[model samples]
Target: MWKKTQPLSHEDIVAIYDVLLGRRPESESVIENYRRMGSAAAVVRAIGQSGEFAGRRMSSPFHHYHASFDAQEVMRRHAAPRLEPRDGHLTNFLGVVIHSKFLPGILGDRAGQVEDIPIPANWHADIAEWGAALRAVELARDSFTMAELGCGWGCWMNNTGVAARRLGLKPHLIGVEGDPGHIAFAREACASNGFAEDEVTLFHGIAAAAPGTALFPRQKTSGMEWGLEPIFNATEEERRRALAAGSHDELPMIPLDEVIGDRERLDLLHVDIQGGEADLVDSCIDVLSRRVAYMVIGTHSRQIEGRLMDSLLGAGWNLEMERPAIIRLSEGAPLTLVDGVQGWRNTAR
Candidate 1:
């Protein structure tokens, strides 16, 4: 809904294009480099298009992978494509961001490469079908709230927030990020793009379990800064830490009763916490029993394979697994998604 303003005078135009970032030296250098290399147009183009960073590695110098995984492991295993388009896939999302001129590597990524960094958590909803669902919800509801468990670079979060609003709902967005630096990036990117800070609540820390509860997990990934994708770094310390943390955040750990405190508050839940959805399920079993009206959970757990399905059925949520990732990547440990992804809202209970 942001109509391009009338063309400005040369002086005014230059003043407007002066993008000043208030964060870090690298951030400033990034902006400066983009200006010097005349890549503003290129950057904008990348942001406006979907999967623009498809093959781009996140970390420059190609050392991010070496920081964790072996070179052979990187090429052989993670190099294989694990993604396929789905319902909510935003074809021109990156394009939109570029048009908005706010894509300066908002995620923890040093560069805007998708591969070197990881896919932001909310990117799980990037399926084409998910896009349709989002549009449908926008057409159906007057307003809605969209919160991301771990919003990376704020691209997905910012894009979806705009979509939610465009869908006609008064968007109430909560982006819970562990790293304050990334949180600041998210805050700036969204605010610079004509969005009010109030529309998006960018938290500098993790979302507390409830009022007084604090999750004591170890790892926190901000999201993808790709280009050199297929992130494979066997020697990376982060990978070691990730391995050490285990199923706590990056693995499947929680039961159902713990995560879902509000049974009917969340209209749509997008859980892309590595493999932590299982733990969330394990923690807030009842949440699956009630709270969420629609969901787009990314499965990484094989033990509770049918856990989400069972909980949804028990709660009377008739959802069909839309994109089954037809090509099985993992031995039954593939990424599964849902669509029409809705739950019954009972007012007479």
Candidate 2:
């Protein structure tokens, strides 16, 4: 619905920076320079072609394939030893082997199949998530440290860690999940991928604003449940009742600050904690800005996406890429059909 020929206004120019560059203008002079372009479309073109923007794009591991989704070319550039197709393991395009037992819900269908180099469409994640997570690894120095909250079988950790290892960088991975079964899966996945015990840590808990306990639903079927969120603020008696009822288990809640520990630099923080992502990120903005270099968050709603933009951008984080949540009309209100994805970079880091 955006008009290309619309005359640029002061507010519109500011929004251009927020939407395109993911930050506020440096000064009035910068806005003035953009205003001289006269049309919104011209300003957009200028920003999109700028070296800063181009540099950000080039940082992604998928940079070469962005222009053309040529999966073969990408595999050729970043190939590992071709993995043998097996019944319980599937190799991704990056040659990272994944365990079939960790595939959740419909993703389990991929089990026991021979996986060729996958195009972006066939991949589990969209381009933005793939680019963001891998970009964090690409930007690492001699060492790469990453943590994943709500990490299902440590998928991102293993994938990104392998990418970092390929570049000769030492990788330290951390995974936190509410499900104990998934935590076991994470441990198995990491070990299978050749990470030493000292290089990997798995936590059976939830990431929250503070340390506490939350009620997480006990999954009856392993690998069949996904998107399970913990119920915060449950009383001790309620948690006991739920536990006795065989429906939920009390999980330790660890704050982001404690999760990262004394790590001087965390290359990536991947979060997909269902609908609680915004609040968790907002509460840990200071830690995020100081320690974490990049983030790829799975947003559950449009409101969550907006809150994330407001909180992170307000704290000087750049919006590297984003795909808004898919919404559909429902009886009560609008419902999110599919979760949105947002990739953020902390400029202060």
Candidate 3:
């Protein structure tokens, strides 16, 4: 049976480490650090700084263990020897080496199905079109500041970063994510991929209309929804229920007005906040219209698609490229196409 784990206290951490290291902790020092930091994350940091934990990098044991467990489970269920970890990484259906947990055939049940088609291959033409659109918006020749909201695991960031670097553009990348698990994985990936901490700044929070805490849907039914829309704009009733039930967690929500700040120009803003991009964009029209030079948005619904098109068009932005909306099918074929990933360039600015 799955048992709920309790929060670890100062004494618990000290006692656990005492047993592991076979030595007693300096009680006064441990208590002082605990009081100063006042969180499990801080306790982990303190442990990393100690002589015993030297060279250990502060990587969470929970993260590694969970990744391993998920990988093994996926491999076993799918009976996919090819999907097994090779050289310490799983080459997913997209041919992208994912160093984290992955679920095989999550795209579809049968091999060679439309969903089984690797993403990079299936979207190769669209990718070219997207690049062309970016070039048309004058991103090809200039250094730019790019921001990605809901940047899960930094895949899009890595792709864009490499492209920007190849173009001799000094890309200032900022990623905003709501999931703590993703935040940690992205940070590790950035480090492993040789990205300087200063080059790619990441904030562990959801993008919304304001900078504050809000109740988020912490319980997920699958991994696909990990970086999906968070319920930051919850109703009073929903908030009350969440608070009473204590099943969900509240996370920091940052506004785009605050993210863009006093910067004279924002070269590109890629929004893939699951289904919440409309709310985020709608909330910061003034800043987005005046400062953002280009944008790529992933619309989750026709309503969201219409709203984005109307908003950007009203703001004097030109639509460069777009995919039309798609409907789901319950028959012989899968709904392989979706009308999302629209591109726009601000011409008025």
**CA lDDT of each prediction against the hidden true structure:** 0.38, 0.73, 0.54
lDDT of 1 by residue, 253-310 (tens): 2222223333335555554444344445555555444555555554433434366656
Candidate 2 residues 88-147, lDDT tens each? 777776667777666532335566555544333233564556666777777688899999
Structural similarity to truth (TM-score) of each candidate: 0.47, 0.76, 0.61
The C-alpha local distance difference test score for the whole of candidate 1 amounts to 0.38
Among these predicted structures, which one has the highest TM-score? 2
In candidate 2, position 201 carries an lDDT of 83
- The numbered model that scores best in lDDT is 2
Once superposed on the true structure, which residue ranges of model 3 sit more than 4 Å away at CA?
1-86, 90-97, 100-142, 219-224, 233-237, 243-246, 329-339
Candidate 3 lDDT tens digits, 1-349 = 0001233455545553543344556776766544443333234334544557543423322112111122222222322234333453444332334453422212222223222222111212233224422443245346667777877666556545544654567766678877666766677656655567877878878877788887655644323344344666688888889878976667888788766666678777878776777877777888888888878776666678889888878878787666543323326532212334577777855
TM-score attained by model 2: 0.76
